[model samples]
Target: MTTPQDAIAARRKLTNRLIAGKDARRLAPFLASDVKVIAGDGSLILGAADVLAAFAGQFADPDFVAYVRTTTGVELDAEGARAAERGTWVGTWRTAGPQSGAYLAVWRKVTGQWLIESELFVTLG
Candidate 1:
């Protein structure tokens, strides 16, 4: 039996893999319709479409390398309908050194699956 935490962890891993592969289209399913994101650079991205656009734009850059997230923790609410995920993320580029930071993601259970509702990422180093 897969617990919700385990399921969320697996989803996070899959999301990381999709980002690393630059598969923006496939990543859509993981985001909520009204998802929001505050990028590590302090840019605000709203909506699933806009988020996908941001990712597509990033992937189009020739110097773009990869972004990978390592989840440190996942906490669920009492109802088990929502969860908060904390992790460290590292982004690499062909022309620049790697940048690493911490991130927080809020997820909701929708249609029996976990979808990212919002994410706030802060660049530390």
Candidate 2:
């Protein structure tokens, strides 16, 4: 039986895979229908298309390297079958700029697949 905890862990793993996937440039394949991304600057990016446009250049940059150290404080909504992963991502980037931030990602299961529904990023020093 698939418990809520298992589902949450699966979602988190999928999230990591999506970020470090071979084709990271295109995120639509790994995102949910209502995916929304909130940048550190408080910009609300709606949909996969908007996210692609906003991150297209950065994702393709030669100096872009994102390393997710650890993910903790994960919470699951069993009834809604949603999960949230909170963690810190530490890494260095040359094209866009250095990136060291805390992130919160909400995921949902659709068609038996877990996908990121919303994400929020906050820069940390």
lDDT of each: 0.94, 0.70
Candidate 1 lDDT for residue 101: 99
Which residues of candidate 1, in runs, are more than 4 Å off? none
Summarize candidate 1's per-residue lDDT along 1-125 as a digit string, tens digits.
Answer: 99888898899999888988997999999999999999998999999999999999999998888888888999999999999999999999999999999999999999899999999999999
> By lDDT, who's the top model here?
1
RMSD of each: 0.7, 3.0
Model 2, span 29-74: residue lDDT tens: 6677678988877889898877767666555767866545356767
**Which ten-residue region of model 2 has the weakest summed lDDT?**
15-24
